[model samples]
Target: MFAGSNRLTIDDKGRLAIPARLRAQLADEYGKELAVTLGPECIEIYPAPVFRTMAQQIPKIADRAKRVLVQRLFLGNAVESEIDGQGRIGVPPLLRDMKALGTDVVLVGAYDHFELWSYAQWQANNTEGQTHYADAFAALAVP
Candidate 1:
């Protein structure tokens, strides 16, 4: 499971190095390939197998609605990438633009997946979301 946060920089070529610990986990499960996709407010990185499972779950619907939703979310922007020998993956142009990724980014481990966020955007998101965190945990408490 991926867990913890790391601050990383995108190189001039727009490549970010996966943290060594995370890289080990990915290597064990996926060899070196990963799937990058647009997430709610950031970019999601998935080990190939996990990505495949997710892809398979996209419901099959009528041609009209299915094409719009599935194509936009699954086919429209997903990029398949391979981790380089040095353990870095290049963020594609479209994904970077979608997330407004700059030089500094926050890599957040999200259990089975990871998310990449621009440093500034992450700060804003965390600040806004922190207040509700206590409520979320409290709701889960055993009555």
Candidate 2:
């Protein structure tokens, strides 16, 4: 049900505060534990239960090579983190390095998780993706 985008900053210590609106939901569902990992083009943050469910189901991917690659890169690099008392979670150096996360970021709500994108990369690609929205909508049978 998460359905919004939030522009945020990475503090000098490499942390981003979870937006206030989502804080209580996250707190009730996960307390302070979160799983952070790589997504196709962004870093993803998920509640512990949600991440565990997805990780468990990853073996269902039929292609062995693709599954292993995803397992290695996504799950292997995944880190379990605690939201500090201040509501911030620090993105690890390795995860930040793997993606182009600058100080500026866009945290997008993605139902079970949040996808964090580099502001520069997001700004550069967002407009270009608009042209394909119609195709995407059609593919989803949204018309």
TM-scores for the candidates: 0.89, 0.91
lDDT of 1 by residue, 44-140 (tens): 9888889888877675555768657776876567888899989899888888987899889999999898999999999999999999999988888
lDDT of 2 by residue, 1-143 (tens): 56688999999899999987788889877777999999888899998888898899889999999999989988998999988889899898888888979789999889889999999888777888899978887887554
Off by over 4 Å in 1: 60-67, 141-143
Scanning candidate 1 in windows of ten residues, the lowest lDDT window is 58-67
Q: Count the backbone clashes (under 3 Å) in each candidate.
A: 0, 0
Q: What stretches of model 2 exceed 4 Å from their correct place? A: 139-143
The superposed Cα distance between candidate 2 and the true structure at residue 15, in angstroms, equals: 0.8
Alpha-carbon RMSD, candidate 2: 1.6
Local distance difference test values of all predictions, in order: 0.86, 0.88
Give residue 138's error in model 1 in angstroms.
Answer: 2.5
Taking every candidate in turn, the Cα RMSD to the unseen true structure, in Å, is 2.2, 1.6
